[model samples]
Target: MILHLVSSPPQINLDLTDCVSNSESDATLQHNCLHVTGSIDKETDSRQFISYCMNEYSPKWNIQSNSRERKFTFVELYKHNITSRHLYLWSAPMDVAERYQFYLDQLSISNEASMATQLFYNCTPPRFGPICQYAFDDYRPDHLSLNEIIHDFYLHGYEPTTLTCYVHLQCDRGPAPACLDWSEICDGKVDCLDGGRDEEHCWQLEANECADDQYRCVNGQCIPYTFFRDNTAIPDCLDGSDEYFESKDKRANCKIAESVFECEDLTCTIGHRSWASPLTSSCAQSRSDLLIKAMFLHKPNSVLDECWSAFLCIIHGSNPSDTICGDFCVGQTFNHERKTVRSSYGIKIEF
Candidate 1:
């Protein structure tokens, strides 16, 4: 069936809501009833014919009209060859199997049985639909498409169930762009260098009483009593709370038996003892063996940093007295120390 209409153009408004409502339930137009308009220009022709195929076309509309108006406009230069009608509307048969497959994909279900099972498990009373994707927004009747409803269901249904907390190891904050480690929390220093979050609420740690063998750091961390005021500038506490009395430079100026020792960057202990005080001095003048032993005590697992520190000692004319430094520094081992360095991929390597 063809519906003939005349209009003046630059544009023509077409309303098919009435026609579709009045049409037979099984009778469908070739053009999708939901959208029934085509473009034509005044230069082409003033009169335009909209053709509709009746029984030959199958209906694809999954919605029923409840007096809702469907209006459309046809406007634009006529680009195609002139034909009997400006617009041909045809009906298409809905492929049940294909439509079922599409519904399966949208619901993320393999079949009806699976969908039913999921709906049963995930949905509670008064919530009925595929995957229990419906929410009560007030009990009101409204026109909505199946696709739109399914999309809303998918959004709420497939949301992540596991909660995650990401830590950004920056002291300052704008965008984190990084993650933090849980172990870094309350370890002593400001782990979140930009924001110093790890150092937050550290005073709370002080409330705990320390044992006789433990020395309490300012941040409330307790360490071996021997580690307290042990002449090393490196604070056993991450916050450097233990070294507040003397700075690295001040400690470097100490006189050992009337010999003034000034260290440029590195700090070392004089004796082979792990708990010995750190004396700042040039790597060449410091005892390399003692430095290595101290490093091992401070960071036992940090083989890479230990080797690197040993190399600096060797470069400064101090012998490491062992091939372990050579084995690690020369790539004989693949262990990494991320504490002191970062890989090219931005992975933190603690030495």
Candidate 2:
């Protein structure tokens, strides 16, 4: 079970179109997974080993065998898109789990980075004999161990869920990385703790209804630029994120009123509010208190019992979503002149 992927890359030329014709049913390996062999216990180490084979090891295959062949690579497991767990999960022969146990043994040798180089060498388990033909093309060694290595790096202090948008989440919240799922964008609540990076340029993904001269950010607002970055002096997108790489010098020296603010356990500087717009109605009241504690785990922007300000709509029992900015919720309050408005029309409603 040793993988010698250093001096030379492993040969990944396997065409198992006939052998593994029906992945779920034809998996002779899967049937054998129940009859655990070797010192490896099925209950304890199987999960990680299975993840390694299905996620780390399989993606290396070149995948030209057939439609079913494409379905078996470990890459599918990386994205969490599939549910079937132990179909072809064996490392050696169907009756033996020694190779898988060896994989776990290597992991215990050291942290991901310092593991024994011998683990990188290629040694096909007996079950691989059938599917080895399915592995067409030279095996590109994951020298970085990107496949075998653990991925809990917490990329940029966010919870690292395949970061398609990296610059948008530059640690406005705290040390733990916040995962940026594209689905979360424009979904109503400001899930990203960064001022408004998650919501910027959201309208672009929707059907076209924008002006020719202006561009749109996710917030559904129109500005004087067409695309995200049009070489403009200032960022047309409200979240300064669009111009992040363009104007490094100006961003190095930003000026905010206080230049610093504190929210609960987190202390933030003006830099933390890079995308905040003080004059704009949408962001005018953006305060340090806006950064909620991630420990809540309810979702981003979950409200606390104490009100940050009466101006926020939550004080008036308006939380359209679990949490939203106060201004967006307040709209035009029924109260008049900061006082209760007495009306002759009385309507009673039941919850």
Candidate 3:
């Protein structure tokens, strides 16, 4: 005798009976039967058992088995013709001959039944035809082959057939380029089946142009000017976009000193000489003229001398004659009295 137990909610009680004649002469009958020995609670429903079966044992039953005596059974109890939930059982008869034969037939007929339930247990039904079904909005299957679908199912344990079908349909119908290919398609140009490339195309310029205070188009994108460094004397942008141009010698109408002393044309001694004499002389002449004009306009003499001297001190070196002095007096300076004496004698004295 073999015992098979099927445990599920809304428990079903099953009894197996076999009658044998023990003594031929007396015609005596012997009865052997299996009965449900344990009581089942009604509250332990089929739904809970089905959930457990699907979660716990589904993966184990996915493999193929060659044994006949071992078989798995799934049963659902019903109330008023509606199946409440499902239950599963693993059974093998102690009578090896009968058990082996039954299991062998079961294995041959339904190898993937358990696995299929597990794979599709939580999956939503496909809502569209072959080409319109997909698991996610952006996912499509037009490019996936049948072999790919089987491989995906085996590896991921999910059916992506509907997704693949939808993808293929879109590909055939020339739907919008999938989001995955946006980079390739929108590479500064428009590439879509609907002649909608213009809407998607954009340009991006390099940073170098912005640093130059210039607006430029690079790769179909407009780049505005920007400053790269602060406190620069010259405008960074040749186009004058970064720091706007004001007067010819002044920017923003802030008076700028004239750049008259270019180093290239200047000789070493002559250069220093000009800095002391000619430059000083020119500055002095301008200051004297300004003072005379101010005095003619009734400006005070006190104000005139202070302003004139201060102006001369900046534009001319403090010791204006030092550059033209002989080797012994190269860096020497005369006192005010000696300078007055030299000027009175018409002497070309150097400081």
Candidate 4:
């Protein structure tokens, strides 16, 4: 059996190698120590033996056996709740403290110890002393911890100075000047800068009175309708502006004569005598006599001269004496003879 002492300052690891088949004997021999028996080569199987000793023996130190070697060798430590200030001892056939020291030296040189130290320092609290009010108030870990610190500062009503500086720079720039030009060129007025009296002059058509259809202005003169067609039929102008007045008057008189004395029947009355008689003269003789008298009155020749004056007088409503009628009958003697021959032959004659 082996006896070992366990302390409280630093945690200790147990070694399981001896006290295999003599577990009961070793337990009775070491009164205050724990006993372990197991094949340490199989670590999982050895844990059962270690668990059994830890549960049954409530000692601070114990020993384990090696089954393959058939020898009792290693020591084990078993503590209820160890802290960093605890210490433990081992009693065995060999110097177990030296073995523990050698084991600790190997552990100290391992990569796990260095990594554990880094993690431990990283989790330690900051040195803010009594000012640390919250649980994580003084907990900072370089760059990672500084990010959380700044975030918390903003949460606790801390405003950065850069924001105020930016606002002040904007105000110092000031408002821009007004770019309006008050010259007449851009003031909605027509500016005559090129020496003209007005900007632009316009011409418009004449007034409504100048467009009258009855009085058209020709060559700046107001000519009446007679001057337009040059017709002498009548003075179409009420003012008689046409120069051929005599010709217009004669034409007017002829139109009047044609309107008043146009032949309506076979016989016509000329100063109480029928100038175209169908009884005393045949129809042909009467028509011939009237045609001859009309021609003589219109254009009188030397043969028609003696009767022309009387015929004109009768046509103008003058009374013809018996002597004028005798002269007219003498001029119509051939026409009377042809009418007598047509009457004797029983032939109907027409003018």
Best by TM-score: 2
Candidates arranged by lDDT, highest first = 1, 2, 4, 3
TM-score of 2: 0.20
Candidate 3 runs further than 4 Å off: 1-149, 152-185, 193-351
**Candidate 4 structure lDDT:** 0.26
What shift in Å separates residue 203 of candidate 3 from its native position after superposition? 5.1
Better model by lDDT: candidate 1 vs candidate 2: 1
State the lDDT at 347 in candidate 1.
Answer: 22
lDDT by residue (1-351, candidate 3, tens digit) is 122233212121111211233344423222222222111222211111110001122223333433323222221111112111211121111232233344345546776333211110111111111111222232234413222222233334222111111221112112211121211222332323345442242332333233354444322222344432221333333222333322332221111112111111111121222231221112112222332233223323334333333233333423454332222232333222322111111112222
lDDT per residue for candidate 1 within 1-351, as digits (tens), equals 122243212111122322333345535333211221111222221222233222322333443432222212111101122111332211111221123334345544433333222111112322322222223453223313322332243334232222112334344311222233343455444435355776687677868778999988654678888867654433464334455433433432322111112122222333321222322122222232333333333323434555545444433323544565554455443354433542211223334
Q: Please provide TM-scores, in order, for all candidate models, with all chains considered together.
A: 0.19, 0.20, 0.13, 0.11
Residue 279's lDDT within candidate 3 is 11
Residue 340 C-alpha lDDT in model 4:
14
Q: Put the candidates in TM-score order, highest first.
A: 2, 1, 3, 4
Query: In candidate 2, how many Å is residue 268 off?
Result: 31
Give candidate 1 regions above 4 Å deviation.
1-173, 176-203, 244-351
Q: Against the correct fold, how does model 4 do in TM-score?
A: 0.11
**Model 3 — which ten-residue stretch has the worst lDDT?**
46-55
